[model samples]
Target: MSLPPPPGTTASGGVPLSRRSLAPDLSRGVMLLVIAIVHAHIFQEMVGGDPQAPGAAFDAATTVFVMTFAEGRGYPMFAALFGYGLARIHLRRVAEGQPWPRVRSLVRRRGRWLVLIGVLHTVLLFFGDIIAVYGLIALMFAGLLHVGDRRLLAHGFTWMALGTLVYAFLNTLPSFTDPAAGGGVLTGSPLADMVTRLFTWPVMTPMLLMTSVFPFAVGVWAARRRVMEEPGLHLGLLRRSAFAGIPVAVLGGLPYGLASAGLWETAGAAETALAWLHLLTGYAGGFGYAALIALLAVRLGDRRGPVVRALAATGQRSMTCYLLQSVGWSVLFAPYALGLASDLSELGSVLVGAAVWLATVVIADVMRRTGARGPAERLLRWGTYREPRSGSATVTAQARSGG
Candidate 1:
């Protein structure tokens, strides 16, 4: 069997497996489940559909649960975690005595690779790829690593307000509000669909980036403060966040959820207002989820139960597992494949999504047992941390000329 990575560093330039903080990984693992549940409904008109449509009571309950707990919340959590990880990497490298310029280069290289991988993922599998959006954010904001705490917070809240406004407006649009305009359907040949995805990716990536900036910024600030890394030290803050944020999110989402479940009828202006409330509160819910998970992680420390281990393993290989989820979705729902998009109800899709996530968790745990790094993560590490031969060569030549 392979051995654990060296102290302080893993192959991916992240914390070593043995040294990783529990909260971030645990939160990521659980957040993937939330993301899966949210994405499951995109192929159907879950919340945007008719308010008077017939459905089972169970399905309606599930719809309410998903809307109030899952929908717009997952992405913000992931975005925050992404920012946290980015800052964590930079901090660790600096602590390890790496130069700032070199760390910047590494960040940029990883971002570029992520963009490429995300584009390919969109073209080949799912259309709603987030990897590229995060990658683009990394590229644009690498310099923020040096910014002060006040500036970082300022930028984060500012972007948060702007992002919420834009997202709220977009959700109020015809395409989102109209049931017929939503849901995924890949018609025609595989190649033809791929071409369509290629076109769609460019337009989608920037829009996603806009929505995510606030969470990402907040994540960076949180990381700088070492919030997730040492949750024990910040119990009061975590508790407050969890207590306040979640209730607001749930209450804000109720109207939309009830309407979507056909339990409450709503029209144009009311629906639009509900959408705004849901999206805005979603950000708070996302942070609350993360904070709550971190608290759990702190409570579960050193215990490392089987379930926790499996979930953390999944989080470590999140990028790979996230892509795998897309593959599963394509096979199950695409018109060229199983074509279950219209056949399956929202509840059914959610079950499938949960199963898919569970499968990845098992796979990830097995890999963890063998001490194997995730394939995508390994590739990213290779690209981001490779030696710069040209720069070294130039240095050597200058030395010779000086001599």
Candidate 2:
């Protein structure tokens, strides 16, 4: 329903395709790759694989690489993008002369739909679904859209500090006591597993929201300035972000990464400190990744290659591709399905994840070439932009205003 707006005009009267920025879409496409790799090992860990267990040299390297670059990295980027998209939608509605109440209603309706869809996704596929959590964030923070820059940035940084502490404590608690103590994976019938997933979703959503608030708030701040939407205008900021954020992220992640990979063992207070460092810098890394991609988009302004096109397409249909990945995980790792989770090594699972991502890229490219909107996007737009009833107050107001 909301495909990249057609060349000159959008049926929805939103931004035109020609006017759309490349950075957000390209970053989303690339972000999914990181997500896939991260989830692959998580799913493997869910079943039987010990991701941090010392193994072959290559596997050790894979664990370190994933811990450093992929894990705790992808989701912040996603949350930021989510915030950016929400701001764009709100801005568009307001610019079209819609009143704040009307726009707020529209956004909240979409958030509710996202929560519903996310619940279904969790029950049907992965237990670690973030969709519903993001929906909740959207609902709670929609009012913050009108806040000043200083307020927005302050909120973001405050949450970052608090969330870092919370996450660090939770992450390192096991290290302090029984690091090996954990629950076993659920290997039940499909219906039973679905029930288990349903139970897990509610608890997971709030925890995720706590960790993601900073990224989401920062994204909103960036969108207010059109940072990603106009990369060239903010080249200096982008360069600084890329140069500083990424290195800090990489360096901060190393101690935890190595320890998790069994290459370096640290416990108690030291491990807790590393966890704090890792998560705090992960936000930086996420921001850096987005800036780097924006810079790349600037460089390839009009000379888009097939790979670039494909990646952009994937980003445009990111929700659809993300759901599709859940399906892949269901097939590949679910105990009731192939049950490959127990069989594959961490490195091996990552390779499989890479393959899954490539497959989605090809699929997304095909959808783009066919001039098709993503199914999930279509559904969301259909729900969010529904027509008012003939006799409704909104319709009456519009008719009176000659809209």
Candidate 3:
């Protein structure tokens, strides 16, 4: 280990484990924008909207914009970040000589708890809760935590290709032709709603893990290189991904975006193919966005403004803010609650989502300023880090021996 962590650890060492780096935190900070934009649509109950005829020009435009940019992209980005964060923790612990079994056990336990949290989130709030999705993905792909970058890249691309193909092929199946696949209408009964969510959770949890697992693996791969940790050294890669990947993502996402915006039309196989196109390129978009943000961080990290500080704080407390988002959504849209989902347009929902995001950011910033860690983060650390850090142990032994 570089050095034993500074002393003054609580009985459980309630303190930062390692020096925080900027890139992972910053990338996570901005990732909420993509998440906010995309999820805002899910809460919108499209009561009477014609896909072919665009009655609301602005809403149609927004759809195209989201299609070209946001949808299908956010979760992948989060998956990558999840991998990156876990990898950082894993590497730090390994550096300190912790056994693999202990590490795996800790990670698995954390994942299980996250699944419970995600279940509660889905039952009470938005159906698109990804905490459970990522939790399972983390556990399913944990064995590949040490895979080298070359193999990881190869497997990631291969899975991306196969996943796209499989998604399209499945959509063409006879059973998939039914609109029942879309989603369930919100029924106000809390008990009835929980039952419905349970039925879907089994299917959804697996599908989410399956689609994002490869990306999560790739994230672990990136973590090994410390790519995000050292953006200055990896400027070329960051620049190339930013320039090349973003443009490709934009073009690839365009067809789906247009189709989503009611500006493009197709039927049967053609529509399915277009859907796959969006899903396919979304991986590139997610990677590109992270790269672009890394480049920004390296170049302008020193210029801390209120906006920058707020974003970084929010990113640091991402888990807390993520749950808080659902809290806002539940209060505003759930059938048992405000039920604005039935009345709001897609664009209107986006605005509300942005406001909610802003509120969380401010809250996170306040926590940062007050020397308080995010409550969820604090709990996670306490749960995952059951024993004191090896660094702490070393310091304790040294002091006891009068070194």
Spell out the clash pairs found in candidate 3.
Answer: none
Per-model TM-score, in order, reads 0.88, 0.89, 0.86
- The best-first sequence of candidates by TM-score reads 2, 1, 3
| Number of backbone collisions per candidate | 0, 0, 0
Number of the top lDDT candidate: 2
**lDDT per residue as tens, model 2, 11-127:** 233653335689999999999999999888776655654543345676777778888988888899999999888877766556555677877877787898888889999998878
Q: Write the per-residue lDDT of candidate 3 for residues 316-356, one digit (tens) a residue.
A: 89988988887887687767788776566677777877888
Query: Residue 89 lDDT in model 3?
Result: 58
Most TM-score-accurate candidate: 2
Q: Give candidate 3 misplaced runs (Cα > 4 Å).
A: 1-18, 45-55, 168-185, 387-403
Worst 10 residues of 3 by lDDT: 1-10
Where model 1 places Cα greater than 4 Å from the true spot, the runs are: 1-14, 46-56, 183-185, 262-270, 391-403
Better-scoring candidate (lDDT), 1 or 2: 2
Q: Tens digits of per-residue lDDT for model 1 on 1-403?
A: 1111124443234446767788988898889998887777676443223322235666688788899999889999999999988887777666656578977877888899899889999999978899999899889988777677777778877877777667667766787556654433366478877887888787678778877888988898888778998899899999998999999899998888998777998777777678778878898899999999999988997899899998998888899889888888788777778876666666776787898888888889999999987898877766665556765542233223221
